[model samples]
Target: MSFFPAVGVGVIGVLIGGVCLMSQRKSLFGALLSMEVFTLSVYIMIFSVVWFSGSLTSACLLFLSFGVCEAALGLSVLVSLVRSTGSDYVGSLVSGHF
Candidate 1:
């Protein structure tokens, strides 16, 4: 219903997407950070739309829970990768010989 929220969300979504897609992220940290940013942007857009509609509170809560879980999973994976490879380089996962 609001003009500004919609415009703001669209702009943020575009900027984040462009940055994530264009950047040559080489580390697992950079990749995870971008993923988190993407998740946050989605949450913000959904929350804003739901705020205007005054419904789908359940959906927002579910999305928040899922986002938290995803972040935790990503962090665990990053730690594991660092411990095993001694670095978080994205190429290490595929290029290193076992």
Candidate 2:
């Protein structure tokens, strides 16, 4: 597909991900998944721009690397939360005990 269409799709993906994140705040896993969606959409947008311009492909790779690191960090936090709180609910973090 063309760059503009790809960018439009990415924008839609970002909006959907944002809405999901806002509406599905009950679980940490769900939040992380939504954030991943957002990240992926952003990557798509950036990659399209770079691909069309034929430059800065390394910038896309750097963004992808950051996204991976973010995912790993979120997963580690989720695991720790589960271990300490025994649940993945977002409410667990608001109880002033974590």
Candidate 3:
């Protein structure tokens, strides 16, 4: 496959990740979605490098596992936050009235 194209894709992925990072999410769900987008972008960049090198397939699998687990943990924490606080908005959390 074309290496440079993959590299370009990786760069685009990073830009997406940056955008996700800079955004101010409205709720825990929004935050989790943003985090996932960031994770996927990083994973895309890593996967591209691994795939192009034609080795370290095992590492790629591990990376995929890490991404899944990270998302799960984030969701669980979000659920807990919503259940205990009764609100999902970031503004609610910031006001210290939850």
Q: Which lDDT tens digits does candidate 2 get at residues 10-61?
A: 9999999999999886899999999999999999999989988978758999
The global Cα lDDT (0 to 1) of model 2 is 0.92
Q: For model 3, state the Cα shift of residue 84 in Å.
A: 1.4
Better of 1 and 2 by lDDT: 2
Please list the residue runs of candidate 3 whose C-alpha ends up more than 4 Å from where it truly belongs after superposition.
94-98
Give the total clashing residue pairs for model 1: 0
> How close is every model to the real structure, measured as TM-score?
0.79, 0.91, 0.80
Q: Put down candidate 1 lDDT per residue, 1-98, tens digits, no spaces.
A: 67577749856975786588458467878877877777777778777788777776789899989999998999999898898888988776765542
- The Cα local distance difference test for each model comes to 0.78, 0.92, 0.76
TM-score winner, 2 or 3: 2
Off by over 4 Å in 1: 1-3, 94-98
Ranking by lDDT: 2, 1, 3
Clashes in model 1: which pairs? none
Q: What value does the lDDT take at residue 45 in candidate 2?
A: 94
Kindly provide the TM-score of model 1 when superposed on the true structure, using C-alpha atoms: 0.79
TM-score comparison, 1 vs 2, better candidate: 2
Better candidate number, 1 or 3, judged by TM-score: 3
